[model samples]
Target: MALTSKDFKYVSYLWDDAKAASLQGDEVALLLYRSNLLGADLRLTNYGGGNTSCKTTEKDPLTGTDVRVMYIKGSGGDLGTLKRNGLAGLYLDRLHALKKIYRGLEHEDEMVALFNHCIYDLDSKAPSIDTPLHAFLPFNHVDHLHPDAAIAIAASKDGKQINEALFEGQIGWVDWQRPGFDLGLKLQACLEESPGIKGILLGGHGLFTWGDTAYESYVNTLEVIEKYSAYLHENFGKKKPVFGGVKMQSLAPEKRKEQAAALAPVLRGFCSSYTRMVGHFTDDERVLEFINSKEVARLAKMGTSCPDHFLRTKICPLVLDLSPDAALNDSQALKEKLQPAFDGYREYYRQYYEDHKHPNSPGMRDPNPVIILYPGVGMFAFAKNKQTARVAAEFYTNAINVMKGAEAVSEYVSLPLQEAFDIEYWLLEEAKLQRMPKPKPLSGKVALVTGSGGGIGKAVAEKLAGEGACVVVTDINDERLKETAEEFTKAFSRDGFITAHLDVTRGDTIESCLKEAILAFGGVDIIVNNAGLSISKTLENTTLKDWDLLQDVLVKGQFLVSRAAVTVIKKQGLDGDIVNIVSKNALVSGPNNVGYGAAKAAQLHMSRLMAAELGGDHIRVNVVNPDAVIQGSNIWAGGWAEGRAKAYGISVEELPAYYAKRTLLHETILPEDIANAVFVFTGGLLSKSTGNVLNVDGGVAAAFVR
Candidate 1:
């Protein structure tokens, strides 16, 4: 059967012949190209959910003779971004020879250790558990994917019968079994029994397809997915109401967003009880549709059917008891109910662990649900980082599609609890978990740095992001803000930080900035009040407008930003930091600096008051006083440098040396020096200290805290 772009109604046919021709005869490169194409679409497979392989003739280093090598995606590698080094290469003959020593299913884990011995390239990456699923097959190229459409049929009550009818026996069917040597042999046997089959549907799992060439295998995988998708879509259309029809209406788009923002921090706080977790929210239409359906709670509780889905999203989602209307109308009541809901989910998870533990099973992990479903709003997914959190939500969305398709055709079925537990607590999975890199001190924290368009704000944002914090880089200057955003985007990627035009003096802009922070990375955990301006003038020379401007931006700005951020921090119930960028003029009496000095003094005192008031909330407020940060300082850029030089009777270029010579340490203060002080206050090192002042002006004696 010839297939074209028109045949792929549910999936995309992205094969570009010109691009394929560029790879030409390099087998490994062609395999990567094919794998990338299939992995590109979420409808085909999920991130890190599938593996691809090809057997190619290679020159053996030792024997200097041609030998067959099986190259497969390595452990923990995403096919979409896979590189040559991400593939594990093994001698085909050696992999085959392992069958002679295989101790059967109970001892299947031991095969993983033996795989190292068969490495064709000594520097090849570690082989994944699915290596055998491709290695044991006779085809030159193979694809094992977890596409939602295929899994829908695989997870249906009568999957085997449906698969037989759909493919007319061309694609075989295999019952659910954990992936290992035993399953590999079963796959081999299935192909042997059906000598002319193009693929096999694994009951309650996914799909496996193979071909003589990489293009053939890629097309075969797509055909199987598209066919299942078309069949499911046809059936879904016949069924007027999906998921038992919508029992509740979704809130309006804006209302839904407002509700999600209000709920995210509280949910994140509950989920992070054991360890800090980052959150991702989705009011995506598909997500809202499922949560609005009558069978949503029931289906979510039944859990996801795919192993890949559950591994990321957990066994099931925690469904909130409140509807969208109630959540919007009575927020206080919703807040009161959240704790009990979270507690119940945690208890349920603990019980699930207790009921399914084997003698040698790994100890229990955090007993919190990764996915949380609200009846009217949408979904909230939490994990160690933003990307993982987003991916978990994506995986669950795929599971929802599978359930919708399965229920439309027959009945959706979840893997048995015991089977899911066995896979979840598998020793191999534990080992993989252990191999992950240790997290940075600020790994799951989010920071909002004001005036980050340049100067100390920019440095502070970069430093925090480097230490694994998601930063909200903000400023009143739109042009500089965009430039800073571009630089941060290049340095940390978009996920690491977001840019916002923040005028801290205005309540509305401050609210908008905080809302941006909440939507981008859950909530703000650290606040760097670095935004300010300086007017060098005597009391007689300074006008009322000058005094008001300095007070509004320097003193009131910090106050407004802190007050807004505290609301979010309190909702999260997480410890937070507020580091104010003050100046030495606050303490030291100086000529031509009355307005700026008064604002600085007020800012310093306000920080102390906030620290005293917020201590009970575990929010630390500190001060960093930096003197003469002339280089890269935006305040210095706007004629303040010339004014300061005039005050000191020195040329503008000579001011840096004079300021350095004046400091006790005789060191020039840079923006980075001020940034380091901010990090010290917020980076968990001084987790116990608060209301303290750190001088970063090369030991300014007058600014030193008594």
Candidate 2:
């Protein structure tokens, strides 16, 4: 009753390799097929999560002799959302040679500069952060992905049992390690040790199987996954593909786009999945089947892709069905379904590690699923890069195959709860986490900009709000704030914009503004304390009366507002960020405005202390100093600049230009310019870096730079 390779079913699709390239023997036709196939996988995952590589030893355009250029899935692509140009050409020689570097690169920073060398298409956001994996594979056709069916298996309690049952002696298992040439080296060793090993399984991850031909690799993948599905079905006593529920069909691309445009915002907040239209394929077949199928539909009632898919996909999919409106109910249901699966997965690792580990043994890896599926929606897999997606899918397929087979014979066993926790919190996955490419993790996050009506504060807010953040513009000047909000509205849309009249100098107003923000979206994730005012005068010219006004706005105002935010943030336990807009006068001495500089300086140091104190809450605090943010700022254009210019015996127009051009890095400072600096401070990666000062001047401060 043991399962064999013959148990799986598949068909191979092929194109003539000789006709793949151009008339120059480039094999364009075959390459096109690989790209098409790769796109197909993206519909299954996200094309950015999978990889397609074409190796040609033919003469390069420059060398005019035998050379291999490996095209990898570049960063910023979603496999199901990829375009033709998404394939990035990597210098095959450089990649192959890099495969030989043995100096223990256990760091992603070390390889960041190195990968920049072989990148293709100057416009290709960045090479697939996983080129090294594709470079080292020794096969003609290598398609790696995190398939939905497979990730569910990999993340399950039954993964090891399933993989072993399906591949038996034919697959190579590699514990979760950071993927790169090192992983490549491990694969090579495993291949050598097991001469007949057909593919490699990256445990707690996804899939990678290759063949001498594209058709062979594709067929093996198809067959292996089918085998995996069978394994899941048999073990769970799952019936045949449930088809009697709904018979939904594809909507026109236009309709899909319209629906996606309307729904993407709500969906991202709900499922945290990428539903963009970037890949070559869309989710017509899968979506229709998922919604209509009785078996898969039952899964919607059950909840999530679970332990298998989380590695490539996340825990759930955002459903667009207006009728269900079930996230409020289903979210709790998902946690319920996840509990048993999680409990079982943990015990499996505890048993294996306790029995097999030695003092020198590597630590247990994560047991959480990389991808999750929604029956009426689609499957999603989360990976560090495209290559990770590839191995993850393969691992997923192997897990599914064996889980199904074992269930055919008897009930499948799952890992224990405690053991699964140990793996989920393991150091091995932590190592891999360090090697992941830096992304704008704040991408598509909405940032509400306070005091965005003008000046450095407005600039800082706009910058953070510009980089994919749904900007909610606020200012004491309702007219100005509305104007700022309208500029963005004209460019993006109403969904991307919001406006509120705010006076950050008041705690009650700040609190009400934030409440309104949460009502509009879900919660405010970023805060740019860019709302402040400066009163100008010499030390001798200044009065205690004017100083109090400056302190109230610069020092007390920021404190009162951020304090209110901390209350909500601490309760939510979210990674909320707070960026204070300070000035270079805080860092260096400022002319004439003695009270202004002192207030700014006090706020700057206060930012540092807040960073240290609130770090436990995972809230980040950073400061930005725009040496000169132009004269048209509210402070200048509001007649404050004219009086100050007269006091200095300089033309009002000359003062701001002097400040702007005086910086060592002589570049004019714009509001959007200052906003860019604020973005880096509040966005991801700076998670560990808080309590910092960023000079937005064109090198005027000369502090951090040179």
lDDT of 2 by residue, 430-522 (tens): 455566655444553557666877666556555554455555678898778767666766765455556887887787788667655543443
Worst 10 residues of 2 by lDDT: 273-282
lDDT of 1 at 641: 84
Instruction: Give all candidates' CA lDDT scores.
Output: 0.89, 0.57
* Candidate 2 lDDT score at position 253: 50
- Candidate with top TM-score is 1
Q: Root-mean-square deviation of each candidate, in angstroms?
A: 1.6, 13.2
| Model 1 per-residue lDDT tens digits across residues 216-279 | 8888888888899889988984765799898988889888778778788888888899889888
Residues forming the 10-long window of minimal summed lDDT in candidate 1: 325-334
On lDDT, the leading prediction is 1
**TM-score against truth, every candidate:** 0.97, 0.44
Question: 464, model 2: CA deviation in Å?
Answer: 7.2
Model 2 quality (TM-score): 0.44
| Predicted structure 1: clash tally | 0
Task: For candidate 2, give the lDDT.
Answer: 0.57
